[model samples]
Target chain A: MAENTAYDRVKAARANNRPTGKDYINALVDNFLELHGDRRFGDDPAIVGGVGWLGGVAVTVIAIEKGRGAKDRLTRNFGAPNPEGYRKALRLMKQAEKFRRPVVCFVDTSGAYCGIEAEERGQGQAIAENLMEMMTLRTPIISVLVGEGGSGGALALAVADEVWMLENSIYSVISPEGCASILWKDSGKAADAAQSLKLTAQDALDMGIIERVLPEKEMGKEGFYSVLRAELCAKIEELEILPLPELTEMRYRRFRALGAQQLAGE
Target chain B: MPFIDFFNFQPKNELEKGGRQSAPIAQDDNEPAKTCPNCHRQIPLSQLWGNDHCCTNCDYHFRMNSRQRVSFMTDSGSFTELYAGLCADDFLRFPGYPKKLETTRNASRETEAVICGTAKIDGRECCLFVMEPYFMMGSMGVAVGEKITRIFEYAAENSLPVVGCTVSGGARMQEGMLSLMQMAKVSGAVKRHSDAGLLYITLITDPTTGGVTASFAMEGDIILAEPGATIGFAGARVIEQTTRKKLPQGFQTSEFLLSHGFVDAIVPRAQQRKTIGSLLKLHSGGAENG
Candidate 1:
């Protein structure tokens, strides 16, 4: 196998054969109960969130599911959530907070769906509300970027006590093709845009945007699941010891410290 | 210079049909002018300023730049700008971006897109941030995000209310992921501010879209918008192309948002100052410890 460039990594992360949120949920979570609907509107299949047991610890599992095959993708909107999807996730998180259960999220999406109906139904408001609410939700959150983390759609679920990304994943504000189209008026230069975006997992970790990168080398499905489960168990154990006020304050400080370096010199 | 082309050029007819009616054009050597899209009448720059940048003939609200906005909303000489020293570096060194930034800075007479400061609205002290659309469409970049975060921090420290006037195209593409991160950064700041029980009001102006709409702009405690302002996360053209459907007229306008319960109110340009002052007064009774 050839070594992956940033663009190649993006392609691989988005490939249909790659492991998705559903795969991770089935592998790492036991006795999963899938929740549905925002209660205000219909359920969004793109966002699958529910209660589950992770290593015998009750946890709230929320993941963006891109779906398998054409029909599934159509139903899931290719992991690009609508407003209802975010609302559903918010409902699950709030429920988790009430129960004192830790929240785990799998982030993988091209972006939020930008259809006319989504905008009219308050897509931006939905995402913004999630960000605000998640900050003070009074529960530990661990978000893993399993694949493509594009723009605000990804960030909507990514405000966590800990944010990890798969080694092969790529996260950026805009997709490389979108960036190329906007910058050069040519989507063909996506490779160049990918390099400029600095969206690799390693780059994100170095920039303090993400907490850790889970390496994919020589790890079979079972091995990957075991490692992820151990990590989650350890993190939850550590977070469970902290007081709620302290945990929420730490989360707030973590976000407040981002982008301080660039502003320091000035 | 093509004298025959000058004679062939039709002005008012093309202006009426095109959406560039709000665009300022040099009608004469005396004063720059703009055509009111609603009434199709030429309004002089001085007259427009006197009318609070609204059309005198039909009361259509025109977009105001950050300095104009600050001057209009704040008491004279009461605005003390914070984080004016912060500017974006060419981290990516994208082609032509440096030159473009310089050009925009020289043209707009501002260092970055957003102006953050402490100001008074009708004797009520508050922190204010006004986005300048003329400066690269008021795009949020690293510096813009930093400034907004700093303002929120400042407001939280002093326990002052935050009043933001948003007019943005989106995140700046030149800065890549750094620009997009502003959404999270600013939203986090708004969260902190709100957690402190400080009042935060966002005044959505013309053409607020993309990451700005998806973040702090939409997180306001009392979301106010200017009458007839276009506000949405995605542009109408993009949505139309994606959905393959014709949108209803005034789909993303402030009126539409008010009807849809997204905005608390749509204050016209004339009443905006008074409305803001009234809100500040009403909310100013409580102490910082609340």
Candidate 2:
């Protein structure tokens, strides 16, 4: 299970058998009450959200669900969420802020849906709203990259106080194939593109884009969820102890300082 | 020439005819003519620039670099550039990225993809950040993000309204997730500025898509776009391939966005200064300016 190259990590990160967002939600939270709809649009199954119990503490849970199997993947749009999914996530996040409950998000998506309908419904606006709203959301929130963290689709859910990524998961601005095609004019060079993208969890950690890399030991097992649930609960409690303004300020600073050190050369 | 380029005579993007333009012309000739992809009329370069870069006959908006945009849109002597020193590093060391950056810097004659600063529109003072289409197609990289963030922070501190004109091909891929995080970073700054009760108007020009669209481009209190400019979350071709269907006519154009209520208005380049100035004045209440 050790991924040697960045491309290997990419493949491992996207392995079909790898745990998806739904798997994490099912394993991490208890008594999950699934919510639905963006109110302005129809509900999207790609995003599954509801209030759930994280170690006896009621928390809002949102995950980008890429269903398993052919039929299920088709139903879940292969985890490529449309605008409604993001809007639904925002609505839930806003509700969490209102109720003063902590929120947890499990992000996994190749990217946002690329169909005409998704574009017509304002996909960019939906994701933009999430980024802005989540920045100032007055409740403790943590996001875990349980699987592939595709560009804006994943970032929509990840503008959190703390972002954790699984050891093998990859976070990137563009898919390796996309980078390959754009840069080299050949999708076959995706492996080279993946290496150049610096998408592995370790690379993200080194760049200070993510806070922690969660161990995949005993992943998908009961022990893994137990440890994650406890860690998440403790982190939420720690964040909850801070004053609202301070918490929001720290969250803002965390992103504000990211990537500020480089580019000094003229 | 490659076989593909031989037949690829039409404009690659709307940057030419469908609405906006970026096709290259023979600049060496004394009387260089820019062929309007929309109207197919050959317009002299000096005359085109004199006409505010819009096609003389069809009024199709042409791509404007950040400097040209600033000069055309801002008051004669009111633009002060900020964050000009900030430039990108191939910290990821992606293959060909450093070389690409060097070549792009030389070609675009820009340190970064966006130029941020303070400017006045019709005597209304505000902060401005115009994306430079000539620089890597105005992609948002780490430095681009940093510049934008600092501009918003500066505007927030100074209590100045922000007028941003976005013309990007989205986040720069070479910078990886660092580029994507700029979306969040800039959004936080934008949110802070908005919370300060200052007006923030976004001017969407040709080819604003991807992370830029999904962040500050759509976060404005009032969003305006150029007519015929392509603006959307996903590219038109990607959507076509994914859906396996022909797109609806005028699918992601400024006019289409206006009809769909995503845009406040489709303002022509000639009318932008006046329109933006009027809005700034209207939004400049005692509470906001105070």
Candidate 3:
């Protein structure tokens, strides 16, 4: 018999396949509202963002949600967004700043889909616009890695004041399997890669790369939900106190300090 | 008595004597530091280095190191290195990795595999980052990403054009996802720089592959490649194995990529400096030619 990991076994036991993160956000964050497309073009399903209340403090929430089944996956573009997805997020982010609401983002995706349609639609331009908006946005923003956070698609929403990662979630430029295949010339090196990737939440937090790591013990998916809600709530409470200018300045400083640690002795 | 004495008066040992004495004339440095491999003759390395590390003899192209490239491409000595202290640590206790890193460090005299700085090209000031393959294969580790992103931010702050010469084997496996995260980090930086209406040029040199290729390597206002360089995401072997067929010759080469529209152009190394300088000037609308 194959040895099973706690993460895989738990995911299997839950059988909880929500179609999109939008579904979970509707069920979880209070007073949720959905925003429409970029004014320039049409709406993109890969990225969805709007204003919502997380523990009574209003926050702008944007997430990259992958569909569960075939139909939904096709609709969601497997969470690989086009240029419009990023543009939509940027629109919401700018609106969030105008309203002085804190922003929260959930990242879950493989990467931005690189199909001909997306490229022609200016996927690169879209992501670039979002990064520019987020860096200059005048509000506290927090990003949660609820699942796989891949490359520019994830980073589009991931530039934030604080980044929280779930115990089983992974964040990377590319997947560990992809890394192994590229480096070792063999896909089978994936297992060896997991150890080397340091993609797990604990490893990321230990490196001071991320702010916090939400834990998981006896509880399964519900536990994940609760931890996420609590963390968002607590962080929201703490961040709500700062004035808009201070929050924006702090956010900029936070990103500036990222990756500043010395690597020689570490 | 011997077969050697049949045709010649002098012994074969005379040739060995010439080889042994005079410290070998330092192996003919008079050849101007470069030669055509096919013709076995001097090719004017200085002129070629000023050009872009190409051999003038037969135009046999060569990859330029990041520093040589920056000097050749940038205006005068305008470069100011940014984020110079960032580097990678050997986290996994990787076999021979420490030794390889040490050797590369001493050889290249750089803290990391990549270098980021600000410089002027064709009278247009731009922030530039060049990844040096000589150092740990120009692997994207934490420091590489940090330097790249910081330079991007610097570009955005200064509202300057950005030129990135991307050449890397891939993410550094020893550093793991930290190395991989650079893809996001640098891509984010590139995105920000581009969104600000700043011109960003991504130039791919020989062997640009893996995550680097997928990310910023392809993300540029104007994409360019060096002639004969292999530029692709999946290596030739993987694609060949997947298709169960031999890849056509030069499948991932710059010529192929350019022909396929994946690359904007395939530039001879000797013309890269002039080409990039001209492009920056054209896009930024600075002084036409410096």
Candidate 4:
């Protein structure tokens, strides 16, 4: 049976057994050291950021974590980040740039947390600062979409040299239910909205929104982590070799060209 | 059978010597009397327009189209529009997008949600972009992003100061991830403009939230907001639903932002030109003296 509908993939991405950000971090990174607090505010459990060794190469790792089970997910705010989470990620990213270490990010969230406290703490400004700084971070950076890559929240960590997505993952400006309700005034039409969103990893790759679609055949097994680890190491090493100007310039150009079809033809 | 009157076009009370402000009787829709949402006073449209689209009664600021904003913000006959008439495609062929664009184009008379160009404000030249509220609430789709990015790049190359006004419902969802990419793209442009040592000022208008806020709107060197404008990282309704707490009065208003130190100043519509002009004069690098 062919099981390749967009809605199917969306559900699969949110499956209970799917590996979360911590799973990837625990598997791929060695000598992991956890860092906390955004310096300006309290620490957010939704985002985990610190230095770690990836194939013996020191790098700063940040992941938006959706903890497994009810209690854990509640503790992590279901992986939706607060302003402090993004700030913490930015702090680590800046530190990574200073030490000439590569920055790796694992993004999986429904979106940034929408709350009175988040708004009061300046979620927009926090994300905006990350976007501006990450654009020219002066270091090799890679972002992998392990699950849902929700709008600006995910994007705060994803203005990278290369953004990759797992096969069943989805990245969208808004969730299908939200989009359906807003556009058609019918949340029941989410499947149709999902089809229209072009949110699948393959769609993202086709649109040049992302660089790669990581296959999910052996996803939860030991072989999956080893393969991903090898690929990440090789890719980051290649990216690290580029001169700083070229590296940042390339990163800028990558995002600059996404919706910029007008420039080429004109 | 009694004859029935089908149409009723009469006011509640016939004409008489009116109250304190019988200043001008509006005859029809063209010269209609608009009621202020704040003061609940009936004021003529012309009087409101004359007062910079703010309520003459309670000073409630009304939303202005890009052209009206540009006309008032710039010197007379100084704006030269750039990146005009760029086509917007239903790139992903999202449901109803093509038809929505068609209706929106017909209604708003703007090809895009933003109008960008170079303008002279108070005798000082700068690159300017004003978001048009009539079009999709000035949503930043591909075209809006392209125009904004071009303006910033142009300003950087010309060594011109940039002034922009932003109002949006965030990234346009019809365009999907492509719409979201604009945030990063425009921020890159802003970064380059900042790196060039030129000033970029953003005048945030009513309801500047979502993707716009998280990107170029907040990236301005000097950020200003209109009085009574709602400025926030998240939508108030969304926050209320998420937090399930009663939001405090004046929670995300311009005054709140000013108090919170997120905004540099809460400039009223009447004082915006003078304040911006003074800032520009200060940052003009002795050009005025020369």
Could you say which candidate leads in lDDT? Answer: 2
DockQ agreement of candidate 2 with the native complex: 0.63
lDDT for each residue of candidate 2 in A146-173, tens digit (9 for 90 to 100): 8899999999999999999999898999
Question: Per-residue CA lDDT of candidate 2, range B143-184, in tens?
Answer: 999999999999999999999999999999988889999999
Ranking by TM-score: 4, 2, 1, 3
For model 3, report the TM-score of its A chain: 0.85
Task: Candidate 3: give the clashing pairs.
Answer: none
TM-score of chain A of 4: 0.97
Q: Which CAPRI category fits model 3?
A: acceptable
TM per model? 0.92, 0.93, 0.71, 0.93
Clashing pairs in 2: B15-B20, B15-B21, B15-B22, B16-B21, B17-B38
Residue-wise C-alpha lDDT for candidate 4, range B237-280, written one tens digit per residue: 87887789999999988898888778998889999998898888
Task: Return the lDDT, model 4, position A179.
Answer: 93
lDDT of 1 by residue, B1-290 (tens): 49987767665665555857575665565788899988999899888999999998899998888999999999889999998878877777777788998999899999999999999997789999999999999999988998999999999999999999999988887877767777777887898889888999999999899899999899999999998899998888778877889999889999988888899999988888889988888888866433
* Per-model CA lDDT versus the true structure: 0.89, 0.91, 0.71, 0.91
Task: Rank the models by DockQ, top first.
Answer: 2, 4, 1, 3
DockQ for each of the predicted structures, in order?
0.51, 0.63, 0.23, 0.53
Return the TM-score for chain B, candidate 4. 0.89
Task: Give model 1's docking category.
Answer: medium
Pick out the ten consecutive residues of candidate 2 chain A with the lowest summed lDDT.
A257-266
